[model samples]
Target: MFIEPDYKYMPTTTGISLPSPKGSRFVASCIALTCVLCFVLPSGYSYGSALLCLTCIPLLLWFRPALSLTREDLWILSALVFYVIAHFVIIQYHGSASRYFEEPSRFLLGIFVFLAVIGFKPSERSWWLGLAIGTILGGMVALWQLLQTDLPRAQGFMNAIQFGNLCLLMGCMCLAGLGWAHQQACPRRWVWLLILAAVMGLAASFFSGARGGWVALPFLLGLLYLCFRHRMQRRFLLIGLTLMTALVVTLYLIPQTGVQLRIEQMSSGLGGYMQGTHVDQSIGVRLEMWRAALAVASEKPWMGWGETGYVEPLVQLISDAASRTQVAELDHLHNDILDTLVKRGALGVIALLAVYLMPLIVFARVSLRASPEDYRLRAFSLCGLLLVTGVIMFGFTQAFLRHNSGVTLFAFFMVVLWGYVRLAEPKVHSE
Candidate 1:
């Protein structure tokens, strides 16, 4: 945990000038390691994070972190609790709901991860190194798979969509972190290396044919600009756009990357869907699933259809419309909002929205008053906002939280960044 919280009476920020807890650096390193472990391993790495959060509980009995919960912090903790309770409420603690409890529990337990950050204040260097190394290696693995295997898309150890979307999200994290890199020793070297890592992460996603996450790009870049506009020259924006355009063109032209084929398939899917010719393609299937999800939600607006309960009625709805019911065969409603609406109903929707919006409220409030010269604070805030935005956008086409990768990465990584924000003590100031 952190510097031993005396939460009853603490300063504005956890920026105390005191020796850190003995062996706290070791604990901090363990925390940082999870960032890399996420991309390198399958579901195994998230266990490490969960373990760290668990480790904090006993330590809390010994001494609190030298920190206090701000208004925003309560919101963070409350959201996690709400998320967990919302799950049990929806399923009535029955069937697959018991097994599905694992994901929601991570959110509730992640409170310790936040507390750990407040106490130990993990080294920023280790965190950045972990991401840079993890993403680069992750990309290499995907590249090897594309070039060597018969599989059309590269998926390290999970679904191609999950693997690719995480890569895309983390890659954007690196890009958003440019300000932090600029402040390091050998600034230019750190900057370029991070840029390269960002490219590798994005490239891996393309190779995986996880085009679903690509929909977030324009908004993601816009957010990055907002976070770092003070530091960027007009010419820098132009250069960035040029590089992004060139990367897209290159990937589309390269046959082995599979980006070209994916784009073509998407175009054809959209073309056929509109013209009403091949209405059973990938896009059409997802579209029909969405329609059915809405119709089904209308049937049971407040208390949703359970995991398996929704299928019969959903199929019946599609049949009544004389539309393809193949989507019922799928496990989830492709959209996260719709999925929650279908299974958990309106209350679940509230819980899910709280998870996304509470964190945004916290980070955006801090960033508003943060000085432009505070690169680390700004970077953390930018990454936080990007995390929320990326997840929401990713959820539009896929129920990302349905997968293990979704819950683990978003819950823990969120607290880690919030911890950094706490360390920075974001407030009105001038350099």
Candidate 2:
């Protein structure tokens, strides 16, 4: 019901200046509230995002917010369509048909959230500010968990790995917010608060002993360097780097922390797996699972084993009852690439690639052409790239997309940023 705008048109200013309907702000506030709940609720908050998405459909239908699509959007949308179709194919192949009704609904809800962002054009500052606050609160909860437990790892609200991954993402967003604040020459205390929030989020990840997020940190830092080196003064960069190094060194020196021990275990496990002597530990089990996945994939290279098909075959390949049990319990292959290859086959791989890479290409391109004044977009592009990097890295040891949090976070941010990018038009004077 909304009027269509030129594909390339967007607001030139930092935020959109549309004359939204009287009730649009109310709906926007509801979305914001959902975001806060998503952050504060330790577990099952992905459903909160889904709920937000469901609400968007009726709002979009009633208000008819402006909508535009770009080439990148088309690529992403096409991938989603193909993925849904692939599930239908799986049903034809007599795979688990119930999954068709289950998982895709979450993704479809994500699509609604995407459309709602474009249509509503909610306040950028409010959205991000609320997210920042929620992130800080989440980080505090993680710290509290660490203090309350005698366990080696702390996972507040979610599992250790997911919590760690979330902290890393929140850390990245804080860095981008810091950069945006600096660009605007905001008060020093405001910048300090952003830095504090980033530090706390990162520290929580370390406390959680989540190796997956740590694996992505180097690349994340590199991205930040590239994003900030040209934008800020040299002294600030040097100071930030020094402080980061000091923090790492401090964490390393702490005797109670399991980071060093975990690294040693990973190395030993990998070495034993390579030497063909041990196949019982964590890393060893992952290797075994991967090997079995590869075999299953080769057998059904084109269309894959379907939702429920891969399990029994993989279990048969594993000789040890314990190992077989472990394999059976795993919902999907730990690796996203492998899981897609097994379930959706080669076509699913292409679709999955499209979903991940299209955003990278689109955001990177937008960032390159962005002027110094476009701090909001620049920060957002970097945040998107960093978030995607973290998720992909996490996927190496886990089926990230198979998880609700993974689906919700990735889809929500992608849409939020792209929606604004679409709405960003060169400022036009009214006659």
Candidate 3:
């Protein structure tokens, strides 16, 4: 009697062969260099970086011509293209195309570079390892900055918020690395490196004093706990519990440290709310800004005033009500949703939501369908958790989506998610 061949035992090549360890090292170096350029290089590098990213696209295509696009990838690309067109329409009708042209094209280019990287099919595991190495470098830079400063001054290549955001992303990467390392066929040394990376990332976040990071940290931690509650090793669970307890204790005990200071600084803006003095002068400013935005929105509810269009109008509106000194020199609205609403109007908001929510939807679907035995699924789940936390925290006090650091990190994670989803999908068998 002849027995059927074991289907599960068949050896198959990964879609993209794992690049050699040296190649992984080179990729890691590139990631670190990109981070440094984005953070430390002067603002003028924005255009140059876009050019460099454009140069990478054809290189990736040449390297992996067999790359096939998935339905999910198509959805993401379509959403992005639609948003670009929508932005141009709004700029043509209500705003200056020149202002919109300056930053948006670079963001779109960054997205292209990111997707190209994802498409390159380097060993699925190598991408996580590379990201972990990049996170280690970023963490070290942040820690060095913290050591050099006595007060909460922005250091390194980015602003305080951006630094904090990087720390937050690094922390997430570290967690994913830990999961990846555990599942790898590598020796003990790689595990040690991942453990070191995770600790360093957490420490960097503690030192950065970014209030937005403070808000995001717990959410990510909670997500990890929920995801791993059932299948994690007992020692791992114990370590996680201890870390959570220590974090809580630290939060209660350390009143003047890290994120606490930033929170206090923001609260200072609300000082008048607590004391009766200058209540109208303090909290009144943001309130007035919100009211002015609403008034503008009512006037052009469909098309919006366009990018930066609200500045002159907002300045004029505030100058009329109070002393020149009282009016805040406004940038984008402090609120992300409100900023989008003012800049893009109703259609812009829909576009913004599509950009933000698509990843969450995609990640959730992937996580639900992922195999219990697959390590890539765990990494994807961890990334999804971090993205959710970052989005919620950013909603409170940041317009991260509009800023360079935020946009770059967002694009990077999008590519990571795309790569993991591709790796997770079951391949078709050919007879």
Candidate 4:
């Protein structure tokens, strides 16, 4: 099925040019806009991701440009390759192809997103504007839900954790956008718009009552401080201090917010947990799952129990009926790293670390550069850093990649930012 193109005698007489840059840009913008819209309407988000992938194939072939792979891309590819190999081993050992097919299929989907974004070559401004639009719309929907819903949380169109994490990532992106716009000396109105989006996105995350996003708040602020340290020292200091003060005040006054309660529960559970008592709490349940996961992991330290070997064995290992009941309900170990440890063993954990480490190293390299021409790329790199950190932090309490929103959002934005940065790099060109 794979035909080698004859570069020597490619049909120039046909006069068929590649897709117009304008058309490609339009499609890329639509993809960004739709992704944001899906934050508030996640039922269609998966389908939108699929459509983006489907569209990417013809676009890439028409362009027929050689894809450029950065060092980071190679690293990410290695991690993905390791992941696929582990799954393939599981399939061969277990004689069932379901596990092998499912996760690899998702990775393939991520590859499509990565390829499509790079192929379209969207402008930086267009991509930021699309994200801004999505953030504003998502904020409005969350606000409306806050006012109308009887439930304790305002999750918008998705579950609380997903909505909260989406808002958190968007807020960081908006901040980066504002900083970039400032550096570019863009219109004051556009900067103000980005500020509004950042504020609203943070507000939506707060209203969602998902503390996982809040776990990354300090890291987000730290990144902002680091990014602006040389450029706007005094200004950033004042803003940072004021924001920190306000955050402290908000936490103190809003006893109704679940954050404080969640922390308390975690603290209490930890204390009781260390004393050999199994406390029935959110943190307690995760501890139980983690212990069971480790036990199973020890049984097959090399390649692990695979996807199929998780639940029943863990349940049987739990001596307490109550703990077993709770453990049985879990689809994965709550922690992403731990899940990888349990599913794929030590090698899997190393690969998982590479997945996070490679991107971090890549972005940090660009972000730390002093070139003015690299400002936008640096800003985007910072955004990518914060997004990766937030997801990793969230994964502590939940296996984020196991679900639809987590995988789709992470994969889409991961490539979108990486692709754009590579495209903008003067030394590297897609063609």
Candidate 5:
């Protein structure tokens, strides 16, 4: 579907250089488009990523070897490609049509986007500001949804869980941006602006009432602390925690936000789960799903049952009819590990683990370059770490990779964040 543009040689022929000033700016706009529209509109984030991915074809054909791509980045691209191939093999083994190809295929396509970002080296400012602006606008959309409709959750254009989790993740990226913003001309104003974006993003998350997303909060705070502990003062940490506590309490007290009701619902579910009474509920159903997944996987260890093949056994394994019915109605197991383990076994385990771990490793290694003076590199590294950590933690309660939005956001954001960190510090990738 991509036409080879006639202007492919324009940057080279006109006394221009690779990674020219104009090229950087153009790439910056492309990144900005990706972040700014990430959650504000329906699948809007993909627009920019599509352009970036499309750019990869020509780059691969023409400039593959001379490019500045590093060994570590290729590690990530290879892992993503492996995921797609692994999933495709699973599909072929199951004899299913390519109906299940979309999700993992996202990771494959993301490799192209990663190549484009690395080759072009998009503006880091564009990345952070675009993230903040997108979260701000997305929060507004969620607010409008809350006030104008009777829906219990403000999902915007996505499922409430995906919408809320992504908003929270981008907001965390805004928090990570503070490190870089300090070096800017208007540091104080930019700091406050990023803080506001963070608040708005959290607000949107609360409004969506996505309790599964809430599971990642402690892990989020932990990662933030690890990344910023040396950079941030103890008082600032205390103050931030105090403010967060106050914010959660305030949101809980507000009836329209549905925060309190959601908490109460979870509490009741847990209590009923303890007494073995409400087997039909969300928490109970998830527990049953996990148990069923484990049971089925034990029967076929290497490559477990196919998607459709596992359901009958899953239903048979569950004792509660209500829980069985609930589980049967769904495609995923509501847990990423269990779903992957039950369906694709060793191949999937490797792919899923790589999808989470390679980026984590790459960012962790790159973040080591954040010396006291280099806040820009530090900021991008922290953002990448925080984003991946959020995805990993969020997967515990949701089969996040099962959703198109989840796959799109994770794949594109990983590349953009990693690319920015590497571009900002050229030596980080080599080290």
Candidate 6:
């Protein structure tokens, strides 16, 4: 019989091939360089590192011209553009253009990193491995910090705020890895290591004593449970509950350590708030600052004083308080929402919402539609959850968007979300 050749049995010449070794190496090096710039750079080094990272954009475009117009890529680009515009507007009105430049530049550099992440089709396994390395590195630094005699000294690449936030985010990442490892059908020794890393990270977070970070923990855990709910078997759920119970017991039993100190501070701060006392301790000053910011916002409802206007406005408002009590240097409002309202008014608020909320919307949509078997989707969903939690919690305590650390984190989350959207796109072939 003149039967057709078995196509399934024959070797196919038309299959889609992965990137070549050289291309993979190039992409890996780019990612590594970006990570170093992010982790190793000093506080104000973002300005220089951002410019260096920007040079990679043309290089990436040259390698993959097809990446220019992807939806995820465009979202990030648009966000950066909006941020830059907002910065310019603040400068035009406030005449402190230089102050906003660093943040905008960091945002732009983050866009380049996001594009680079999309260019490399890293598997979910590979991403976890990369995060694993970062988590371990951060954890070791924190452990060493813990062992030191200096109680209040700032060590490592990040400050107390940055370190605390990084630890919290890294902890979430490690926990996600632990969840994935448990679900995998292979030897899962790495899960234990990840669990240890998470503990260390949490410890570091507490040691750093960033009060806002403590508020972010429950939100992060809740998001994790929600994202992995389907994959959670009955036994897994039972074990999780048991573990949680054990953790609570351990925490309650242990002496004041790590986050316990911050918790105590928060309790005292809440007491001060309820009593309506200006104690200048714990979070009392922050509440006072927020009230002052509100007053400033009321005075300049339309467009506020401008980017750096809060310093003078805040100082003016707190003058009586400073003189009567003993407070010094009321620099920032310490609340992102209030700061934006007082400084940039309604337009700034809109920009801030656009920058943060858009990613949440995109990632939520992707999470809902992603296939159950897809791992990258899972990672993105977890990352999206972390970002939302971080934004909400950190917003209450600090003007996270105004500082380089917060801006950097915001950009990192955007890049991860961009990676997800880019990976989800259907490939087209030219005839």
Report per-prediction Cα RMSD to one decimal.
4.1, 4.9, 6.7, 5.4, 4.1, 6.9
Please give the TM-score that candidate 6 achieves against the real structure: 0.82
Worst 10 residues of 1 by lDDT: 1-10
Candidate 6 yields a Cα-based lDDT of 0.61
Which residue pairs does candidate 1 place in steric collision? 2-119, 2-120, 3-119, 4-64, 4-65, 4-66, 5-64, 5-65, 5-66
Put down candidate 3 lDDT per residue, 90-134, tens digits, no spaces: 778874757565445644665665554444333454445555565
Clashing residue pairs in candidate 5 are none
Residue ranges of candidate 2 with Cα displaced over 4 Å = 1-24, 27-31, 42-44, 183-186, 319-322, 424-431
> For every model shown, what is its TM-score relative to the native structure?
0.91, 0.87, 0.79, 0.86, 0.92, 0.82
Task: Write the candidate numbers in order of decreasing TM-score.
Answer: 5, 1, 2, 4, 6, 3
lDDT of 5 by residue, 1-431 (tens): 11111112224444444554455566677778877887767878788777766776675455442356678988988888888889888888888668688888778777777666666655566776788888998899889999998877999788899899888888887898888888888999889889889888888999998887777877877888888888889999899889888998999999989999988988888889879899788888888779778989988877768877889988899999889888889999988888888988877888899989999998988788557778888888888888889988889888888888888888888887877776678463322
Off by over 4 Å in 1: 1-23, 93-96, 319-325, 426-431
Model 2, CA-based lDDT: 0.70
Please write out the lDDT profile of model 4 over residues 136-177, one tens digit for every residue. 777787777766767677677777877877887787788876
lDDT by residue for model 2 (229-329), tens: 98789999999999998887777677566666777788898998798756777788888989988999999988888877889998888765666788898
Write down the lDDT of every candidate, Cα atoms only. 0.78, 0.70, 0.60, 0.69, 0.80, 0.61
TM-score, predicted candidate 4 vs. hidden true structure: 0.86
What's the CA error at residue 78 for candidate 1, in Å? 1.3
Greater-TM-score candidate between 3 and 4: 4
CA shift at 60, candidate 4, in angstroms?
1.1
> Which one wins on TM-score?
5
Q: Candidate 4 — number of clashing residue pairs?
A: 0
